[model samples]
Target: MIFIYIIVAILLLIGLLLLDFSLGKKNHRKNVRFLDFESTTGDYQIYTAGDPLFEDLFQDLRHAKKKIDMMFFIIKTDEISRELLEILKQKAEEGLQVRLLLDRIGSYRINSKVIKELNQSGVEFAFSEKPKFPYFFYRSQRRNHRKITIIDGDVGYIGGFNVGREYLGKDAELGNWRDYHLRLLGDIVQHLQSTFFDDWYLATGHHDEEPVPTETEGEKWIEIAATDGVQLEDVFESLICQAKEEVFIGTPYFIPSERLFKCLTDALERGVNVKVIVPMKADHPLVKEAGLPYMMRLIDAGGEVYMFDQGFYHAKVVIVDQQLCDIGTANFDRRSLFLNKEVNTIIHNPRFVMDLRLAFLKDVQDSEPLNDHLIQLFTIRTKIKIGIARFFRPLL
Candidate 1:
């Protein structure tokens, strides 16, 4: 009888272990391969400065007729946040369905009082994966690092703008903030709207009251690529492999996995022109040091690297062969390409490519080339930090 009980206990333990592994595997596979959104043509505009982006966002919110769905990584107690909160509050009061999803850890600085007021005013809000001490490693680490807005399901937004004064360059310490955002219109908006509901459903477990899907007519080649960081590795490599002439990437950080790094260097070996632009002013201090090894390796392999001096270049975009353009919230770093949830819009329109190329050139005018000499000047203490940074690249 005692032997039978022992055998039962061992089997139960094994069953529990297998269950945990299966659940983890399923969660990692949550990143769908591709969006089956209806094909449509629409006018897409790129916003590089904070002032115009903020103005356009506020206007969109005010013009919203039915619903407003917004998700962001950070929401501070800055001027912009206050203004946005006021607008969202007003909209909720006017009976427009307003849903907000924020990353709890990213927006930790947000005032509890403001959140309470918004809740009382009928602004439905919830933080994505609110951090807990026991489950900090896996659960809280995978943040909804995506920033998107679906206004009335007709207009859509994707890119890297959070509600903060730093994005407007208002903070002297961070200097002038330079970021990129996209204002999209068309049936493609419907796809993005539904994408928001996916996260909303996970956070709240009920999406019956989610924003209504809206579609429109069009004829452009725009595809939405969603990722939880694992498949993004393949998407980027495949995208780079298709480049014929040149590949230009603009990102705030550069911390890709080893395999992806080889893809770029290999492309360079084939005489393809490869250029990358990263910010001189790092929002995260250690990030600048962490990216040095990758920078040096790329430069050594005949690839070019540039440091944006105008301000913090927080734009994550890629243009391949002047024909293919991809822009969204995913950076070249491991955090965006491996750990966090991110989205990028892939467009095959020449007009859109030209627009992005022009913006890249304009930004280049404000950038200075990066070389080995600059990287070697770091003190031994900083080198120690770089070594530590390399070990924790995925976490960054």
Candidate 2:
């Protein structure tokens, strides 16, 4: 009788595992969606410095007509953030609709008093996930990693420069930070606004109708690709599968999914030039350790990878065939691809792509070519770390 009971338990466990696997597959298929680029209808400018990006943001806020909705992963207490807060407080006082959303883990160091002040001053703000029931689970894991700013429902800013002096290359320890931030104008700002409210709605129950931008028509086609958990990986996988001739990539992290690895290798097999650039020194040592295997895999498959020697390369930029480009917050890692709320732009403009390619060329000039010998130099401890990190890659 005991043996019969054990057999029944084993069968039930196998059935449960199959059920879970089936749901995961279905959920992945249900999550990815893309907008077709009819034409380039937007005017966009890419910024690489925090100083310039903040200046433009402040200037827009000075002339903001209706609303300012912002979301970010990191909101450090730097001069830039302080000035931004002061201006936002002033703008809210002027009866403008202003809202801010930040990741609970990313902005964990932010003081509650500052938050209270913002609240009392009528500047609406909230963390992406609060420490309450149902939300606390995976609150730290599924972070809001996107950095986006939309002003007056007409203009938008997207890409990697978070609120800090390091982003502007002011930190002595980490000098000359390189990243990409784009200024967007046109109907696409409406899509950016929708992305913001998607999080705002969850954070604050903001059920208000989406605001319609009053901007003039644009000259090119721009589509926003934003997702949270299980979908972003597919976005990049599709992007890689569609590449032709050439592909340039920049990011701080690189832990490609199995599907992504296959797509990149396949792109190379089709006679495409695939260039991947990552930081020399990662913020998380474990992250760097986790990615070495994939980096070697790409190199072994006839792709080129580089390590930026200037400073921490935090920009997530992808330029394909000098005709299609994507710039925004998603990195080529498990966190950005599968566990975070990310926003990226799919742009189809040859002229813009050319400029982006130029920027990438400049960065390549400053980076060191990566090879298998370099990866093999890591200490045994690091190898152990890589193994452990790989075990957790799906959740990292």
Candidate 3:
């Protein structure tokens, strides 16, 4: 009798969780905000190394004349991250109007005491996507995955790299972090600035005026695609559908939606060369396992897949036929497609696109081809992880 009672209680708890999860998603859909800005002219420099990226960014932070606004999905509570926060604090103390927004779940390691100190220091720190009532479980899973920084309304930074010692290639297990970031100085900075303010409004319920648009020397054009937990899958699908010759995808995670998978296969049928690269090892549990099925399907369809062995390949990039390129926070995964706020920049310049493709090919040269032997290396434990991961794919 007690065993039967226990089973009933477990079922009841699961039912309640499902109810909350469903309701949370429904509520989120009602408040969805999608912003697609037209292509604007900008000058950009790409950064693949962490130390140099932060070095230039920190220098820019110190040279800020007016205001500093920053947002990141994750900022670890390590020495490097603390150094960043200290810089922000000093800028704020100097009356530079420093505002920092962080995803609640991603930066949960930042304790309340630290938040209090940042606020006390005039940093105007706030957490986005706080897990609220009625569906805390589901709400917690939805994240703001954008990593952008706007300085003095002139320079802007966007891409996959986040603040952590690991991101600086300090992790013993995940040696030599590999990623991409863009430093922008041009009219395009205004668009990123506007997006940052919009997110800031969502988090704090406060509105601030935007700065004047800055002029650029470069003539290259770029478009901004910002999604609020919706539309990213369709965006990537459209990009892939337009590919005439080839498509190169690089992401840390590769769990694709059914529609996306079909689109890739269709591209393959059309003689488009589709190549994807994921990290050889996973930094998170179950993520690599969840992607195996999709990887296998792509391989079966004559598409190519590579496992980046040089380091954890965290670059979220897509290059189509050397004509277009996208670089930003959105991954080729469901979390970026349907569960997180993401931002990506679409570049139409052939020169920039080719440059990115070259760098991608270099990374490919450092990676190992995913073949039968690699698949055979999956042990029983991995098989179990794959089974569990498939069951929880959406949340992954």
Clashing pairs in 3: none
Best by TM-score: 3
Give candidate 3's whole-model lDDT.
0.91
lDDT agreement with native, every candidate: 0.82, 0.82, 0.91
* lDDT (tens digit, per residue) of candidate 1 on 283-396: 885788789889889999999889999878998988998888888989998888766888788888887798889889888889988886777677999899999888667667
Clashes of 2: 8
Q: State which candidate, 2 or 3, has the greater TM-score.
A: 3
Question: Model 3 segments beyond 4 Å from truth?
Answer: 215-217
Each prediction's total of clashing residue pairs, residues at least 3 apart in sequence or on different chains, is: 2, 8, 0
Instruction: For model 1, give the 10-residue run with minimal summed lDDT.
Output: 31-40
TM-score of candidate 3 relative to the true fold: 0.97
Q: What is the C-alpha RMSD of each candidate to the true structure, in Å?
A: 6.6, 5.2, 1.3
lDDT of 3 by residue, 24-117 (tens): 8898899898676888888899999899999999999999988899999999889999999999999989988999999998999988999888
lDDT of 2 by residue, 226-264 (tens): 877666777787778788799898989988888888989
